[model samples]
Target: MAVDDFKAYIRKIIHVDMDAFYASVEQLDDPNLRYLPIAVGGSSKRGVVAAASYEARKYGVKSAMSGRLAAKLCPDLVFVKPRFERYQEISKRIRDIFFEYTALVEPLSLDEAYLDVTVNRKKAPSATLLAKEIRQKIREKTGLNASAGISINKFLAKIASDINKPNGQKTIAPDEVLGFLETLDVRKFYGVGKVTKDKMYQLGIFTGADLKSKSLDELQQHFGKSGAFYYQVVRGIHLSEVKTERQRKSVGAERTFNDNISSEIYMISRLEAIAEELEKRLKKHGLAGKTITLKIKYSDFSVQTRSKTLGLFIASKELILEESKALLYQERLKNSVRLLGISLHKLNSEQNSSELSAKEAAAASRKHEQLRLPF
Candidate 1:
């Protein structure tokens, strides 16, 4: 509708998300399970769902939801533990396919990523065509389905990716940007959470149309720095670039157990295993951070996080295990814990991460080999 909307998105971006990634992998590995409602999370009273298959979603199951509730909603729901290693292997193949078209790939997780193909190795004329081809290659290479969204910018691409999911693709042309956004719910706008949506409703902003009607000053009066963001986003203005080399602020792993454990001894052993896994990730990524955070989720779904900042960057298994146990011991358990995680933050510069000592490299290899596979 306006010159501004068309000017900002000269670059083409695409977001690809694997449909029900972990759950889909589980189903692909076991054909008989494909017909059933599959939930790839934990199957315990305290477990949370990691991913829900299309069948599971029919009964209102979703990722990060409690497994107990999922079972309640779908009585015949089947649960399986996550296999991160297998997922990682598949992700590499998917990314390799992306590299064939463009070198600019930014991974959000093992299951989702954003790619900028404005200038590509293939020199494709249309981003939509690129997205379609990428999705096809991913399915062909991995035997897993992926969905893609093609747009001029990241914001639109991310939203469009969810339009027709499960091995589908959508594109938002420049002419239709404003109209497409106007019909979208304010709740669906990026960064507008449930709390923010409620606030928007109270302020009489129900959809993009409502959000667009508000003046920048009125928005600033309500949402602070984010107000300015909403002002630009409602009009399809996003300037963030697709970065090839992305830095992770944290690296950690957590697991949900089949049964809630109240024993301190068991928790210590589990924490050690988690610490070993974290060290392997840190070594693999060539990262070390100064702040170590321990996350605990209780049987009742309540979560707690305790963090400690050190004077030096540390990524060794022994140090992570030591600090995590210290934080764990400090907490007085009011409930049987179900999930535990350790993440590192305040990462050091990446310049020195690649230069691991011979001993350190050997230790990392051993850690990788000794990983306690959940599945």
Candidate 2:
């Protein structure tokens, strides 16, 4: 769409982001872990960091960095395995708090969400006040800190949320949008990644002010389709609304290697791990998918995906492994692989719910038996 065609909007949106969620949870569970450098996951050379504590981050440790490097960066970094079930429970508790204020909630991930509170359940006077209340409630109930950003739209709101670190809130008012954006570095704009930032610097577009000088056509000529996006957003013209219903078309999990591997044996082991994680997610969400896809990213960063659709929905780890293995061998490798992934598509929620019901029934029966036994 042309930049001129963008809609004009000034809706109140709030972005809530948890502070190092997985790492914070670990600290909350054990007080001794607080104030210490901690990383959740990536204990092995091949393992990757899932989350890092603030103390660990100070030493340049981060999620997606190799466990070995994280350990090297912070010699005292304590590594702990992730407990997805516990995280899910905490996520639910936080979401329940969101629903108390507004139904126009869109969860970006387990740790962050965008809320449209222009008109809300409690009739709050300002989005900033609501952000404070929501953050306070989250801390009180979950024993964790959340940072919030409030602004006229999702773009500004998301950027505002990050202005204050752990347990803080920032608001960008409607009238102040342009000025606020002008001072912001071009690199700080939501969608500008490392490569784009470098290109922007090379083109003398170092700040939002510099970027605003370029016409939509010039931006398009230099950056292709994303040019129009950068042109409008810098001028405070993002028109995306807060969508309450964001559906999951597919579920996937992948691992990025610190080094590429050509060994089929190592590849299968990685695929097995990916399939297991995908299976856990499928069961967690009560979803069964008929199509299974295998994604591969080579050392050069070139990516490829292969998928197969079955006649019926299935949510089994063994089956995921079997199908993904077939896809792995279906095509010859262009280069050594650096990442492997497995995804489930064409989901059937009703079938998945039945399977969850059976599992719940069996667990209840075991509990009943235990209660009946004399101690």
Candidate 3:
């Protein structure tokens, strides 16, 4: 095909997401938690839910909601602490699954990713089939179900993927794309969060069709910068690129013990090791974070977490260990500890600095080794 004709041909984009990622991992690892109302996060007064299983969703539990509120809503809700290392490992496997088809893959988190398989290694003509295969591979390898959405662009593909979640697949072909957008709720449009949704409702924009009626200038006048994006989306036009180089916001290390531990001294020692490892990573990246969080899992599958916001970005081993240790001290572990984790958050400036330093260090190390006699 000629370059122009190829560009005109319908593109295939797939959005794949693991169902209830953290909670699902807990369920997969523990037979008792399978098919149960599970939450992956802390279940304390000062805690929040990181992820919740489908069963727990029925009881009004949600991510970022207070754990106490979730327990009140669902008395039987099982809270399992986050095992970030396990999640990272599974994420790597999922990414590997995507690469089997196309190298144009973008990971949004440890549980969700996007792939542009316009020209795949398998030479499969249908994006739908490729998505189905990827989901299947993820399940077979990780023992988890993933939802997929296939469309021509990232916006529609991401929306379609969530339509049929928890081991479901859906596609929006070019011919049906407009009709699909017309019927979609305004809130479902990318970037239309709670505040924007409320503003659109006030203007009688309940559906994509309603939004399509407004001129670009009118939308811009109403929404400023975002209005242009809204104008484009209602008409099925989204130009955001599937980025391959978005720096990881944070890097962490964690572990889930085979047996639950209650000794504070033991837990502190383990946390100290994890923190040291994390600091090494931060230094290697030449990056730092302003927040440190400590995660704990209990024998009963209950979880507890605490975080501390530092006044300055921390990159040294001592600083990370100190913050992690302090956060752990703040949490009250009611049951035997099954897991522990340390994570750094809110990374921005450090990314560039870290990347440069890492490159320079690698170059220097290579030079030193090359100069040394290989006798």
Which regions of candidate 3 fall more than 4 Å away from where they truly are?
Answer: 1-10, 249-281, 284-314, 317-375
For candidate 2, the lDDT comes to 0.84
Model 1 residue 277 CA deviation in Å: 2.9
Between candidates 1 and 2, name the one with more favorable TM-score: 1
When sorted by lDDT, best at the front, the candidate numbers are 2, 1, 3
Worst lDDT 10-window in candidate 3 = 366-375
How high is each candidate's TM-score?
0.85, 0.83, 0.71
Cα lDDT of model 2 by residue, 21-97, tens digit = 99999999999999999999999767889999999999999999989999999999999999988998999899989
- Provide the lDDT at 276 for model 2: 90
Question: Candidate 1, residues 154-251: lDDT per residue as tens digits?
Answer: 89899999999978999987667889999899998877899999999999899899999999999999999899899988888887877555666678
Q: Assess candidate 2 and give its TM-score to the true structure.
A: 0.83
lDDT for 369 (candidate 3): 16
**What is the full ranking by TM-score, best candidate first?**
1, 2, 3
Residue 308, candidate 2: C-alpha displacement in angstroms: 4.1
Pick the winner on TM-score between candidates 1 and 3. 1
